[model samples]
Target chain A: MTAKISPELPERLVAAALAALERGEDVGLRALARDTGVSAMAPYRHFRDKDALLAAVAMRGFADLRDQLLAANAAPDPREALVAQGQAYLAFARARPALFRLMFAGHDGGPPPIEDNAYGVMVRRVRELAPVSLEAATLACWSAVHGMATLALDGGLSPDGSSVEHAALKMIVAGISAAKRS
Target chain B: MTAKISPELPERLVAAALAALERGEDVGLRALARDTGVSAMAPYRHFRDKDALLAAVAMRGFADLRDQLLAANAAPDPREALVAQGQAYLAFARARPALFRLMFAGHDGGPPPIEDNAYGVMVRRVRELAPVSLEAATLACWSAVHGMATLALDGGLSPDGSSVEHAALKMIVAGISAAKRS
Candidate 1:
């Protein structure tokens, strides 16, 4: 049992941390260890501090986000796929506001290197359309979707089912396609 | 002299609150009253609680943001003016991140009624180009700019003067124009 449980300690601690954040409670290393039914020192062995544990939780968030994006990317049309991805992104943020905020927090010195995660999913779809100005198009798309999600979380956008968000996503895709032409 | 000084007490307390937020300190009514050299109970004359004081500070932030938007709207070309307005919005978020976050926080139940503030300023510009789809166009434009500002604050965008941000703004404007044509 020690052999089986010892290797799973890190995963258990991270799960506890994620649960804490989901419930809108401040997470700490000691609290996580207690919640995970482990010696306080056990968490320290797996994670240097609370930041390390939070980082692990954030990674899980990114992976979950990427999966949603992948599922949303199944549309036959490239443009529709992008819009679906945006909707998926918004849904993820809304469903996990605390985790979403935590995932993007404290990315020091530069943009978070999210290329291997959800961003790469967005990039692949963006590249299919705006290959020439790929970087700008991708940034614009991400900014709009992220902004919508952030606003939704902050009560800056309507809480009800928003046709407004749908139309805005279409306008962004149309705008990028227009830019390509010009 | 008492009459003159008494009226300015709320403003002085608000200034103190703003200062504390700027310095990245948690603010309290007692602390703000102390900072303003007022008796602790004196604040209750103007503000019911800390939330009321913070609300005043957020109001001041919105007014300041409107002023910046008004300044940025002075460009000769309408599209140029909109892009400039977005840059100013981003600049405001970066300059006063804590205050910016506070301005948008706890706006429960629905989107904050910002029609009289910065949102009104952007709506006027968006009206010029997309008169038909005004609601959707305005939301898209606001979402894009707001997202960019939020991203810049969260280090999701590069810290150094981002050409990507500029290019993204241009694409959004261009996209809205294309939507209008269609």
Candidate 2:
């Protein structure tokens, strides 16, 4: 749009968009371009439309989550590590509700499948435990945590309330045992 | 904005909006009003804004899901009924992906929590079965099923191709059994 304000226009666009999403603000290309201190039409050069820009933001979200998941492996015990992973997932969701929603809302084509993303790390963790029914264990653990993450965000869980870690620990243990039984 | 042509303009607006959403098209007030064959501003009278309209649609979604859950209770056995409920949940999501997403996506202040909505029905059903740990069982079954529904929508599950219904059934059955053990 003008003399390139920054060579990293694409990166800056997505970063600003992510910040907007995290702040519970709408992400529009024009708004993003302005936020990034770029020319009004600068975003259009990198992203086809608003949808494309949102997709890039979600991609960055998954990358952020991947790091968090990997970092959650701070325990020596596999079980503790598994539980930590669950907590990390929920914590990520709570900390960045809008961005987290964007990641799974299919808002921009459902965030692309990243090979080193959180889900991939989760599957590997489950396999290490060697449950009787890997499919059942994996789905059960993932779904249960995913559900709670969303539920927690909505404050939709029982009014009595419990921590995500406390709740996730119970479900993960139950789900893993269920697989073991199978 | 034209003079009211019909008394049911609000209902018609939501219906048209729901239709637009289910068809994988974006919902816009002006577009919805046009689609409903009403005045360009007719939707504004019923809903303060686009978010309000989306929230209303989500409310309708929960009500619809409640009915389906009840209908799924045709089975006499409680355990069978539980599995039936899980299947019904996924069926509802598959049949109405947009509304299903709307139900949980928290559109425009999110949908109001209905007393007789699907989640309430789910809690009641789970309590009736009397699981070992009500909270844990509820979270596990709900999360597992919720996970499967969203995962199936995104095709985010294991590539081996187990159907969402199949995976949900296993986790639900196992969850209930675990509760029974507790």
Candidate 3:
């Protein structure tokens, strides 16, 4: 009876992993367990190993990014939508550089195993916004926003410094809009 | 008899380090020496240790980036100049991701050590074009361009197996131009 009451172990495991990421875990099962205040052995029940746990965390991060993109895309104006998306992307990176690093950091298991992850949702968002071929539009939008966000996360662009990220993001929005218009 | 023909040993050592970086040697002086065709004992003659060698490599990357920016800024028109600068920046990243990584790998050494390197040149190029505060203009331009370069390097923006670096770069230039006009 006690074991059955724990219930929905996968979601709990994912949640615990994400919380660990937010708290600055280094994308390892050991760190995740440490961050979650759980026994390292506990994660094994839900995930096969460290790779499985990382995949789950990556999936969650992608979902979070996709949701943020969707919300921003639904904004009243196209320009505002783009700006909000850029800001949202940057905010996520700043709030979770550790996870952000894992999302792009080298993976030993070949091409990222991110199927059906946030990338698809992101592409869908781009498709909804621009009528161009999904390939061109996704590449265009992703490069612009991702590039802007990466710079912000690294020391290249500082929000607190005189060279604030807001101005750059505004230009990114304007640029995307102008490109679409042309 | 043996001291005859080599140019400045420091220059040769720095050149060896850069060459190692160019060949995509992963970080560490031993790997660099192997890539540079220098003896294992060679680097120590110029750099006090591996850290100093890495600093030289990073400094060189910045210097190269700065030179490219200056060349781009010298283009005839503002629009042309921006595009040129953007292209140059992207090209540098593509040509040297390993060195690029070393320059921003978050070492304990403060950025101030490398601030006067290529990054300074990039900031100065921005200062030359904008009427506003140099710090602000520099940040805006750096964020946009550096952001784009980073995404390109990380494969974050790849879609449909296409390289959209140039297209995204055009948007960045457009954004910077619009900001300047405003």
Candidate 4:
């Protein structure tokens, strides 16, 4: 009998894990099985264990975010690029709050096995665009945008009350943009 | 049977939880019980559940942070105050990474209820000292410092082996201070 590989298996598995996370719960093997359209034991045969599955899920989240960031920054205008990136950041946080939480929740069973992860890609992009040191640009861009998303999602800033987060994003983008003038 | 009161109960429980977090773990109740010298089940009586205890832990974290922010802003010199606040923010993030995470982690149970509990105090202080709108000052100061801290902790900017976190904090502080100046 020829062993057939399931092309949708990985995608379905990750989707399930992310869905569980979206509900603000842990995504162990059983949960993943339930979330996906496959048999419970089917994931075990593929992923080895929960940690392996989680690692894969985390990588998928990062990759998805990276793609989103790239798309947002693909705007023709540099100014629009920044705003697009900020809006994309907010959208990602709002859309996948749990996955967003997982990305930085810092649950390091070990350093992610993958080299040059999502953060590496983000930092590289910032360095490519700005004259500042890689670290400076990365810190400037990530901190401002990440901080806004975090506060908004974590209730540090109100989303419904005052448009405070919206205003903050504009100011932060302005502040970072003003860096070039300096 | 007489109802027992452990005056030291709250502090001990909090210390245990914070230590578990600082040590880098999920911080379950069993560990807290051992660390706090209470029965494993004891905390449930004092706190409705793990989430309740975590909420208290987050509250204490914010209170301590507020005290530090107040000290920073109270510096005799204006510029010095800015630096102090930024330094204090960094210190808080480093000293209590787990509690810091809990403050904004938005865990499965729910986000810690400390947002309305303590953020108002900090915003009120920012409004009094800075000429900007309360929303502006709050976002300017909070996002600037918080942004820098997140970058440092996530290893996004420090990959080059320099403490770019410190630099980022300085830049954010400068940015906010400059805002105040203009």
Per-residue error for B80 in candidate 2, Å, reads 2.8
Q: Is candidate 2 or candidate 4 better by TM-score?
A: 2
Order of candidates by lDDT, top first?
1, 2, 4, 3
Q: Ten consecutive residues with minimal summed lDDT in candidate 2 chain B?
A: B159-168
Q: After superposition, how far is residue A76 of candidate 1 from its true place, in Å?
A: 3.4
Badly placed stretches (over 4 Å) of model 2 are: A5-7, A107-115, A130-132, A158-160, A180-182, B1-7, B108-115, B128-132, B158-165, B179-182
Predicted model with the maximum lDDT: 1
lDDT of 1 by residue, B1-182 (tens): 24345557988999998899999887888888889877788889997777777878888888899999999999778799999999999999999988887787653432363636688888888888888888778878988888888777776677874777888899998878666532
Model 4 agreement with the true structure over A25-77: per-residue lDDT tens digits: 87778767766655678877777677677767777777788788877767665
- Shift of residue B117 alpha carbon in model 1, Å: 2.3
TM for every model, in the order presented, reads 0.84, 0.87, 0.69, 0.79
Clashes of each: 1, 2, 2, 0
By the lDDT metric, which is better: model 1 or model 3?
Answer: 1
Worst 10 residues of 4 chain B by lDDT: B173-182
lDDT of 4 by residue, B31-149 (tens): 88887766789887788888888888887787788787776677665555665776777778877776876877664465533354345545554555555645665675676667667
Task: Give interface RMSD, every candidate, in order.
Answer: 2.4, 3.4, 3.9, 4.0
Give me the runs in candidate 4 sitting further than 4 Å from their true place: A1-8, A23-25, A36-49, A109-130, A161-163, A177-182, B1-8, B77-79, B107-130, B159-163, B177-182
